[model samples]
Target: MTQNEPAATTGDQETVALTRPPTALSGDLSPRSSGTVFESAEPPAAASGGEPPEDPPSAPKAAKPPRKRRGLLIGALAVVVVVALGATAVFTIEPVGRVFGIGPSAVPTEPAPDPIDPDFALIPVDHVSAGPTEAGLASALQPSVTAAEVGTLHAVIVDPGTGQSLWGNEADVPATPASTTKILTSAAALLTFPADHTFTTTVVAGPTPGSVILVGGGDPSLTAVPEGTDTLYASNPARISDLAAQVRENAGDIAITEVLVDASRYTGQAIADGWDASDAPSSYGGFIEPLMLDGGRSDPLNDLSQRVGDPALEAGNALAAELGATSVSAVDEAGSPADGEVLGEISSLPLVDLIEAMMLLSDNVAAEMLAREVAIERGAEPSFAGGAASIIEVLGENGFDISQLELSDASGLSNQNLITPNLLGDVLSLAAHPADESDTAVSQQLRPMLTGLAVAGASGKLTDRYPAGASAGRGWVRAKTGSLTAVNGLAGVVTDRDGKLMAFALLSSGTNATVARPALDEVTSALRECGCR
Candidate 1:
């Protein structure tokens, strides 16, 4: 089908990897919020009023052991094994050889002619048994949640195996979700659009000769980088060079003088309401335009590079430069005629890859664009308000409760976004849920969302996190990180010591991100270390 045609519905797609190689966005974003408009209520005090008296306190139990990094523990075990082998060779083996007179009598040994082949495999989880008991999970997590640094919190942990709640604190209360909002945005995109779907950007003949129009198909991954070079959008992105080549080949002997950009596929303000004004041209986010090079970044290779003021116009200029025009200028914003001849066109990487990039980089522009795609597919107006409404509607159709949800933008850059912790946890649970008869079609489509999350201490925004007290979760935890001055959040999945997969969401407010984020990490680390039964 053509790029403008209504796309097919969401269906089973190949599972995507949650982690990816390091990129420019890392270390550039500060873990500070611009402001906190929502003040989350503190955890409630213990049972009050008519509650009965409890029994006397019992004796204190032994202190829990300190957490250990996975890599360090494995190294320590390897050292012990090597020392044991050395001792056996020197003492036990030598003594046995001497007593049996085997040292002199034993036949000489030689290495095998063929080399040993390595074996690699994925061991499936033993899901017949349930994960940690609810009481045990509460015991293991309560202390960490109550720490002062965590501030007012809403959190939940679930065993995805049975979709059971293992622990919770004000989980139903709605609060600012920060970037964890991407979870819902991702889930909706997977449910509404086919996995291999793509957006196209095309160059067509303008109304007059020596003029051409650049029409956007709502693809922000269109890039200005030289062909064959990598940009912040890792998947081989659509290149302006290739688009120009096509236009030049088709428009023979025509000296292109004017270039126009048509970002008509998307409607509404380039910036969302409630978004911080300073963020538009900053590293973390940019104006949400449909046609832009490298997601509107001034430096396509640098994730932290400042964004351009008018991304659509700038894209038109790039095409002008490529066409050898004297100057890049958008002669008309009205758009090309319906009968304009197609000069050239290019398509973005598959939608699945775009979702992966959005999650891995916590990319705001990509998220907004994807959300608009969702809106378009569902027949909602392709705008900030329409995208937000369409996402909530899609999730609701897939069995999630949307009563408490509120959104101003799909990227969660807006401080106005509000989502319950339970809702976030549920979305994650479905994403991580096992494939079986009981699994919903929504679960199958959302599985790719897991692969896009940042791995703790390994990739993306979580590359340097889970330190010290949270070391045990370094490789075991995979989550999406969120931060806005006093707001912080972590939502994703982790496998515990017992090999049981669990999904969790933690949103905090009334505290600085610097302290709350580390505290949140400690909580997930506790989950990784617990074999709570």
Candidate 2:
């Protein structure tokens, strides 16, 4: 049997057809068409009755057109071409964009070439040396200076730009900085707050119409008493008086029978943790409360009887009296004014100006208040801890190495506070020449500091020390004086013989400050006579 034939079955016969229909190359094929016919060309097959002729093997359909192969090759070549084009475009565009196009303008043109003179290039603090050479100021003061003597002397002389010790007996040691601490507080204040910023004291109505509360915002310079009046010592604070007048004006037909002062903003803890309990509770170490009016005093003139209690309550009482109210009481809670009207509000000096005053007078109270303000402004815990932390942050930001420095309070009241002369000098330099010129807060606020310094025996604590004369520091030295029992400190700017401004700090501990003042004055005289040759 042929391969195409099926095996015979007993009861049925079946035929299998294996021929496939011919496919036209383009369109349908016709019998009369000119195309070749496979049937006429084939040899005759055996008759159906005879043994089936051996079926010839059919050839595979014309091998499929090479279209698929061509398509795959074209796709591969297209991908290659695309890749080449992209690479060429990138290579051609990059250098052109860099050289001709605006691309950051060649590393910023070297920062406008700093205009510092080479000869007067102030020595940087880090590179200062302490050897015994003509250029080394520390060496001149070392041989005659003893560690014990170092702690006794107050004045120190050094280059503001360089941390080098020019001539100081106890330059390396730490001493009570007194109001000099205001410098740090001012620095931190300026850095944390705006220059034009003012402290607001609001007189808000209490829960009842007849009751008004005085809210203290720690404004150290607030005053209700007139300047140069005997009643100034007995009268109420200025802002409080204004608020009372406003209430009276608003309550034209009505009468305020009761006034309550609210002093609840600050913590009850008045004295700092490290403060000496034995020390007198003078106005300088005034109570620390949130609602203090006129800096926690009933009168600015007399510190002895200036009633120290809840400040807000005092203010409220004063306002009540001024408003013709019959009753006044200190309230722990806040309340609205009797007339439901806002009384006149008073603001303390700007932070910069306040700082300046604090610096010049070396006022401990101002320094403490400023420190608290700085703490509050920085969103830190509003206490001595917060103040110290704020100071460290400010110093670090201004490029000070505060690793060896320790501070407990802004006034340097605590003996625990310690700082080296080098660090102090560095801070002075920064204060004198702040990195950010736009920031005038510190410079403006530090005016009081300069005014507070002993003007060559002109006034304040230094009135008798550095007398104005050819032999004394007349106009050559202007500095802040610090004294705390055994601790003595003097830090400020002085103009040398060559008219160069220099900042210095001399701190002494473990000696009588009164006795050390003369020696410190001598040191200042030496610096004025002998320029840093």
Candidate 3:
């Protein structure tokens, strides 16, 4: 729900795979640097020796003022030199040396830390503590979670290492999850599809001569941008113009007259149940058509631009213009000719990239498309009901309890969605589980969701959050945010002050987002700063 604001207040609202760690996914582990850095201080001078008694007559300069005294001074001087050299070593080892507050490297040139590695599998492995006890965590969280702004809170904190809830407050109660519903959709997609899978849009010969049929492949990211232009969704998206070029070349000098659009891949309502019709033409979302350009945006380059009501037909018109056709129309109920010759085809970006983008930007359109893809793959109807049922089915099969879960759409734009904080915590626990501690097949497949989460106050919809009282969680918390009229939710993982990783979920109802959001953030910030053993 944190996407670009829609004009009509309808637009933006926005895995389950189990497998062992695959060799192809391995990478160098880069853990978060632990331990404190302190500046080295000079040892206090030895009592000053009374400042040499104001030069005291040059101390009766006898030939080296006693051999025993001279020997002692030489020994002391040797000790000082050795200590200084060791201190210098501590300061000169670059990043490693900076960890110890000694030596010449004590004063770092840069104050800010380096960015965290984007790979989720490479999370920090060393934990200094066993994690907070339930009592301790409750003590630290009670005040924040119960604040006036956080109405009817349902929350839980879990230690991913053991898959146990350490602290909770009515966490089993169901609440509107808003955009956090993407967690279920994204998980189901990853579980059902290969990471490198792609969707293809194709053009083929129409039934009539000099006519072409454009077949939709359910790829909403397809763009109408010119060859040299940049795209908002994919780095290099499949272009509509390219398809037209292929059509021109294949057809030779034949005069192209009509373009028939085929959107038979998806069935049922173009819009999901409970979604506001005004939302589609605004910036938040659009109809879930099989064929659409720039996610149905009126302006391809502007993410917040209004969307078209008939994206499938709109796509057909674009192709018609490119082919210099005189008329464009949608295929009849019977659909495009089954044996039409393939004229031109383009593939979308890989599933892995699309999922990441969907999570990061809270792309309502992308979420819906991917959800339907999951439904289709699972042999369910490709409608809103089917997509919702498919997500619950896949997650339920993979060992998650769905007794209390309910969904109306993949994107949380629908207010009908209900999810328990405990369930979300369970999903995040699997995602944040350490590889060495848990070898379950499901955990590995869910690992990528960790990287997709927005870093609090640093990335995605959370970029503007975690200010002031909650600033401690800024870069430390990675979460999926959800917000609607009276619903606010956050679910993610964070490393506590003692280096222990914990997954948490907090859902608030009957409160304004502006107030509930900050209160929820404060509670998580408390978790980040807690050493509540």
Q: For every model shown, what is its TM-score relative to the native structure?
A: 0.77, 0.64, 0.76
TM-score for candidate 2, residues paired by index = 0.64
Cα deviation of 216, candidate 3, in Å: 0.9
Candidate 3 C-alpha lDDT tens digits along 283-308: 56778878999888787765445578
Model 2, C-alpha of 400: deviation from truth (Å): 2.0
Ranking by TM-score, best first? 1, 3, 2
Which ten residues in a row are the worst by lDDT in model 2?
A: 70-79
Per-residue CA lDDT of candidate 2, range 16-45, in tens? 111111111122212111121111011222
Q: Which stretches of model 3 miss by more than 4 angstroms? A: 1-124, 127-129, 468-470
Computed on alpha carbons, the lDDT of every model, listed in order, comes to 0.66, 0.47, 0.66
Provide the lDDT at 71 for model 1: 12
lDDT of 1: 0.66
- For each of the candidates, the C-alpha root-mean-square deviation to the true structure, in angstroms, is 17.1, 42.3, 21.4
The segments of candidate 1 whose C-alpha lies over 4 angstroms from its true place after superposition are 1-121, 331-333, 468-470
